[model samples]
Target: MAVHRALAGICLLGLLLCLSSSPAARAASKPDYLILTLMWPGSYCASTQLTEKCCKPTNGEPAADFLVQALETYDSTTGKPVTGCSRSCDFKILPLVNMLDDLYTYYANLTCPSNSGMPHWKDVWCTYGTCSSLNQSLYFDRALRLREKVKPLVNLGSSGIIPHATKSYSLEDINDALVPRIGFSFTVVCTRNYILWPFFYDDYLSQIRVCVSSDGRSIIGCPNGRESNCGDTVKFPPVSYPVSSTVIELPSGDEMAL
Candidate 1:
């Protein structure tokens, strides 16, 4: 009887170890929510300094709209980014070739030392993409599709929040315009206008962060809640480009890669 109990204990321990070490277990350990970060081109360019290079794509200037910045995975419990899942990045461009046109149009690299936006895409894939349950192709495809579904420009414009050089809109109005249309709350991010230094320091609408389910299909309320540093009123500036490339060090952070 004692021998039988010992053998049973060993068997149960082995079974537990096998299940815990499986691929499914590894995937389950990852975060189950994603944040789709969308950046407004007008605000991005307007916040730039003369030293900071903000160029239009060689192909042409992308539409005056909100561009896909990143699709980041975040911990639902702690509301922090999940990264460095795989030690080996193993990023390849071949799988993303078909989507290059849409990528360039919607997610182009505006900063100086620009290539085909591959470096930026590669960085994102290696960082956040590897952390998700998606391959390189599926990750980029998902972000693009989400951007299409959340037609931010159309949603905001319908609410009479189109970009203007001199016009400013209240933060409340901006939230009201987006939350109902998106079916979920989002974080309104803003950047300080460096162009108008000490004279008139104003915040410009920079990025909108919408949360999505792990499957990357349905929009979900951000676990982090709607957080913003925007003032009472924020400007929505017009998009413009420098004829010559102005050079400055690129900003760091997963969201500022664009």
Candidate 2:
């Protein structure tokens, strides 16, 4: 019994040490808002001179796996007990996975040949199932026919607006559609050593990148460009060229291949 108690104490101490050993650990020590940036289907992917893997469309299993891993990491690090990371009340990933899964199935069904002896999906009797009949040159044309079906997954849902409580505001409250000018915090998380957060804001503005999620409708970090003193809203998602082509220097005196 004494030996078992000592072993349990040692295990607990090891767990505590692991939780306090690094900046990432420290950042995860408390519950903070995690910014989840899903890679859009159209977004550029990393590539190498010898490999043209960049810009390739994600497959059915890979995308889902990536999302799951991201959510698990965020949950484990944040110490926040949440069921999942979807757009629902808790902003967990389950809903997003379900959305993408449905899309993948739809796309796969559309890829099937019409005369494959398989029953056609309801109301989908058009030229969709005949993708196999088209030539390579006509592939793009056929794919465009499915564009409307795939568009919703590409858009980032709105993060919504922060109201003054007394002021009347105009605009549909949706993510990516528009965010109001209000107090917010810009959070950046680097998953890999070389990854950098892509955002732009002037230091002169009254903005702070607090380590916690904005509780209300306040801007997550900074207001829109219309409120800029220079009068030109700073374009965000600050230019990302190929990381391999451009060089970036890390704060730790390490040069990145970017």
Candidate 3:
């Protein structure tokens, strides 16, 4: 009987040790801030056929130039060479899920935050928060964590929420959010007009961007202005089917102010 008891105790100790040493055991339960800002029509691309200094939509400026300039924040420690980015006119292309996943992983692993020593536009800038902020990687990490947690929660491949290549994921397809803190606040531009969108079937222009709260609990639209319900609460179910693209704007002339 005493030997049996000792054997049971040893098994229990081993179990505890295994759990404590696992990554899931030490994983972050919640972080202070989480953010994700998605660009629209995917992002801009420059004309490959043009060599002239000036060109219209057919051979115009790239969109990445405008996006990088507007956001002014990126991972300073790590960056990749960006090409065909301008303001005049550019291609708006959406990357496949695999490509996007690579980017997210790379950003999450960066160690430095300084903008100096960067190559060309590869330098990362800070917008709402500084690059040297504590757990800057938290934002990126959280995105990864969320993706893992939400993967089994829903069916992303055939559910029609995002590209089929996305097997396991979390957060909206527009932006990836991960952080170490519990709560935070900041503003980001909404590049796409999901509520009032154009190019309904196009792959690049389908998503939109909006300010996200730090906790990853809720999201509100329309940050600025004096309307009573400026950032009112709204909800959208999982994209399980095809839906109409046009929005009702204002329900056939209501008395509400524009």
lDDT value for model 2: 0.25
> Candidate 2 or 3, higher lDDT?
3
Stronger candidate by TM-score (1 vs 3): 1
Q: On residues 60-136, what C-alpha lDDT tens digit does candidate 1 reach at each position?
A: 23556788888998888766887767766787766766776678778777777655566778788877888987888
Worst 10 residues of 1 by lDDT: 248-257
What TM-score should be assigned to candidate 3?
0.26
In the range 1-258, model 3's lDDT, one tens digit per residue, is: 999999999999999999876645533222223233332212222111123121111111222111122112222123211112222221111211233332322222111232111121122222222221323234333433433333321332334433322232233331223111211222222212233344331122222222233443344232332111112211222322122232212111221111
Best-fitting candidate, measured by lDDT?
1
lDDT of 1 at 108: 72
Off by over 4 Å in 2: 1-28, 40-43, 46-52, 55-219, 222-258
TM-score of each: 0.78, 0.24, 0.26
Best-to-worst order by TM-score is 1, 3, 2
Q: Cα deviation of 70 in candidate 1 (Å)?
A: 0.7
Candidate 2 on 1-258: residue-level lDDT in tens?
Answer: 999999999999998898676445533333233222222211122211233233311233223111111111122243342221221211112222324343332322212122111122211212221112223223222232223322222321233222121222222222223223222322212111112333532211111122112221112333222121221221112112222221211112121110
Write the number of the candidate with greater TM-score, choosing between 2 and 3. Answer: 3
Error of 3 at 245 (Å): 38
Pairwise lDDT winner, candidates 1 and 3: 1
